[model samples]
Target: MRRRNRSTDRWRLADDAGSAAIEFIFAGLILLVPVVYLVVALGQIQGQALGVEAGARHIARTVAAASGTADADARADAVLDTVVEEYGLDRSRVELSIACAETAASCPAAGATLTVTVRTAVSLPLVPPVLGLDRLAVVPVEASAVQKVSRFWRDG
Candidate 1:
């Protein structure tokens, strides 16, 4: 009987079989961390924008309430402060510009336009409170609102 070539026919696990694929899965998460971070960061930016726009709309209403002429710039600034203070946003991050146009029926000018801007540095979410390495997203966001200054009065 021929002797079995046990040494030549032995089966052994190779280190390379599907090892690369397993490694890829782990590495993929490392690469994906940044992308996930960016997605979350964007949500914070959107929140900031919405907050500013809401603040602007409220300011317009305030202007309409005053019987006297409203200092558009001052009003805009004040509104920003009120809204951002609670959210830890800096007033300086916001920009306020107003235009006054003569109206047909004693309107508070044509309208008051307010723009609020927040750079990533200022508006980064407090939840993370640190920089992320995954997706390097550092961008500013802006929100704007224009309100028609109608006859000023609040009878209720």
Candidate 2:
């Protein structure tokens, strides 16, 4: 068999010139875009989770340490507001619930265990507002904290 000429083969290869670069860019975008978006979404979720957890814990502590039910309510509201602002959470979306371990008529009673729960949804970054996509593409985050009120606690 006769050997083929290298020059002819080189010309044939020219048809695919720059194909590797194009393929690389296409594949990289296809893979890297999702990865980058996942990272951003996870970061947002984690931040919101931490914020919720902090809010619950702090509110529980504040309520447990308050002098009376009215004081506890005020302190909890203040802490929740601060936490929402600091964490960039939507105040309108945030939900808070407070309960006590004991079946006492009044929550946060003296020597009772106070439980506080904070819940919210984290909207994914770059989500479009159209078609309610922003609302649908959200991760729910919830946190709860429990603290014991002082046995000597008294309401004024």
Candidate 3:
């Protein structure tokens, strides 16, 4: 009887030893998956932010280099279209606003400041529309740039 009880206790201890390892594996998986997902999401958003910043600078420079108001507007639109295509962003979701610190009807005036703003929203992956987190899941990114028209620029 004493030998049988000792053997039973040893088997029980062996079984319990493996339970901790199994639990540890499950806990690690549960923590790791969400962290990986968050990292991927953040990387994508950072890329979009960089694209927007570059686009704003390009648009401002393009407008400042134009010869006239009409030319500036056309060039700005073209640059914006290129940015949308290059960044793979939705046209309707992206908002562009331009403001001229000086005369609005002129392109290259001396000391004129051309400001360009780009705004877009990035939607997080695997975000469900429940728990009132839908709005929180969408991140808004904005970039602005200002360029001055050269003093040597001549209006046509």
Can you give the TM-score per candidate against the true fold? 0.56, 0.89, 0.78
Best by TM-score: 2
Reference-based lDDT, residue 118, model 1: 29
Native-referenced Cα lDDT, model 2: 0.93
**Worst lDDT 10-window in candidate 1:** 112-121
Tell me the lDDT of model 3 at 49: 93
Off by over 4 Å in 2: 1-4
Off by over 4 Å in 1: 1-25, 70-78, 103-138, 152-156
Predicted candidate 2 versus true structure: per-residue lDDT over 10-114, tens digit per residue? 999999999999999999999999999999889999999999999999999999999898898899999999999999999999999999989987887999998
lDDT of 1 by residue, 15-101 (tens): 356888989999999999888877887877667767666766676666654444546445656766788885555566665544444
Candidate 2 or 3, higher TM-score?
2
Candidate 1 structure lDDT: 0.56
Q: After superposition, how far is residue 96 of candidate 3 from its true place, in Å?
A: 1.1
lDDT agreement with native, every candidate: 0.56, 0.93, 0.83
Backbone clashes in model 3, listed as residue pairs? none
TM-score of candidate 1 against the unseen true structure: 0.56
